[model samples]
Target: MPSLVPPVLPGGALSGREQPTLYADGALTLRPFRPADAPAVALAFTDPAIQRWHTHAMASADEAVAWINQWRVHWAAERAASWAVTDADDALVGRVGLREINLFDGVAEVAYWVLPEARGRGVVVRATEALARWSFEELGLHRLTLRHSTLNQPSCRAAEKAGFALEGVERSALLHTDGWHDMHLHARLTDLA
Candidate 1:
């Protein structure tokens, strides 16, 4: 009989890094989403900016809970890592995560969004920077990429501020409610030189 257990990484998990309970830097903290955050999560999706980019309008708290639950599955499967961005008061401010993670290739895509009230407060930028650093220093990722609609200037700025250089634009890369949209790609390498 063949063994069913898969090999684990140095941390005894497939992710190859310790999943810390919290990541904080002064005013911002990144922690796993909890069930209590459902109302906030549902409300966030109602914002015009979130709707325009995310394209998923969460209609109820139940839907938000389901989404939150899925994040745990993603983390366990080593497919992605998501964190709830919180402020000094522990209020949910935004979210940041690594998606499309290809551990074998040491590459992952970073994604984030700030709640309407959190916009212009540098929450996204700070969270992204912290996550990128963790990806490189802790997860041993060689590269991290971020992509956003070419029309999302704030996203572009966040990526830039996190040290991700603009790579190029892909036309019609994603289909949204308004039809195909061009995407701007940016990337950062563990070794800048």
Candidate 2:
């Protein structure tokens, strides 16, 4: 039986084309992950801040390579899309992406992390804004959500700076090594009006 509402976006919306490299204010680049970035990715997972908030660590470059490869698979499956955030020299500064994509609903969740060296420079916020624009304008997504542990002030600020409005909090929505954390939910719609 068919539902009453039609799909918000057609099928093959993302899988039909190559993921494009995105530029942010000429200062940052968002590109598909490459195997060569494994070392930098592996090193980034070692940072205590990244490990704490994300709750997972890459044990080796080999592991990071596998993780990088999965992003391509996710794109092909149309379930998620991720990009490596880089600086002007193409140095890996962090990562950003949309996950849990629901084409019928035109919705996805935004996620990102910044290298320790790139933290204070607003890299994540810039990347998030760029990715949001692409998702709304290019991918035709109607809404994008971003969630973070309530204890993660930096992430909360980045979400707001990227135009994601605070919606509410989820009680004990995510579990970390330390314990379960309350998550702050933020959302951005394609049209604010």
Best by lDDT: 2
lDDT of each: 0.84, 0.94
lDDT of 2 by residue, 1-193 (tens): 9989999998899999999999897589999999999999999999999999999999999999999999999999999999999998999999999989999999999999999998888898899989999998998999999999999999999989889999999999999999999999999999951
Write candidate 1's Cα lDDT for 1-193 as tens digits: 7647532223324444446655656689898899999999999999989999978899999999999999988888888888999998889999999898876667889988889888997788788888887778766788899999999998898889888999999999999899999999999998961
Candidate 2 residue runs with Cα over 4 Å from true position? none
Residue 72 accuracy (lDDT) in model 2: 93
Clashes of 1: 0
Deviating ranges (above 4 Å) for candidate 1:
1-18, 22-24
For each candidate, give its TM-score against the true structure: 0.90, 0.98
Any idea what lDDT model 2 has? Answer: 0.94
Give the CA lDDT, 0 to 100, for residue 54 in model 1.
Answer: 79
